[model samples]
Target: MITLNHYLFVSGALFALGLAGVVVRRNIIIIFMCLEMMLSAANLALVGFSRFRVTDGLPDYAAQSLVFFTITVAAAEVAVGLAVIVALYRTRQSVEVDTITRMRG
Candidate 1:
């Protein structure tokens, strides 16, 4: 039977993978994707915890509300982040981290 620990372990693994990708990858798009993955991992953990914490035979709404807000914010962040990445790519013609760093005046 699946349990809270199972959900947590999967979430931790996913977050770790995302972290490693962000740390090692050079391209902006890949890093951005990793960031999103990390966010999703966090959301999974939150939902898992809320789902497991039974109260009066009902899942907690408070934590779920927080998760809802987190998703909303993450969506906004993706929209803005993608726009910025697109603009940067157009200006520099490259998505590499080093390419962005050389933009210093």
Candidate 2:
């Protein structure tokens, strides 16, 4: 049978993968995707905990609410982040992090 620990383990693995991607990748778009992946992992862990934990016989709405808030923020971040990436690409024609560092504007 599946358990909370199992969910947590999976979440940890996903988070680790996202972290590795962020650390090892050079392209800004891939880094943004990794950041989203990390957010998704957090959401999964939050939902899993809300589903499995006992809360005095009450539904765990708090964690779900937090997840909702996180997703909303992440959405906004993605919109703004992609816009910035596009602008950078237009001006520099490259999405590489090292090249972007030399940007004057």
lDDT of 1 by residue, 22-96 (tens): 999999999999999999999999999899889999998888899899999999999999999898988888889
Clashing pairs in 2: none
For model 1, state the Cα shift of residue 72 in Å.
Answer: 0.8
TM-score (C-alpha, index-matched) for candidate 2:
0.92
By summed lDDT, the worst window of 10 consecutive residues in model 1 runs over 96-105
Write one digit per residue (lDDT tens) for candidate 2, span 1-105: 998999999999999999999999999999999999999999999999899876899669999999999999999999999999999999999999988767486
| Model 1 lDDT on a 0 to 1 scale | 0.92
Best-matching candidate per lDDT: 2
Which of the numbered candidates is closest to the native, going by highest TM-score? 1
Candidate 2 stretches greater than 4 Å from native: 56-58
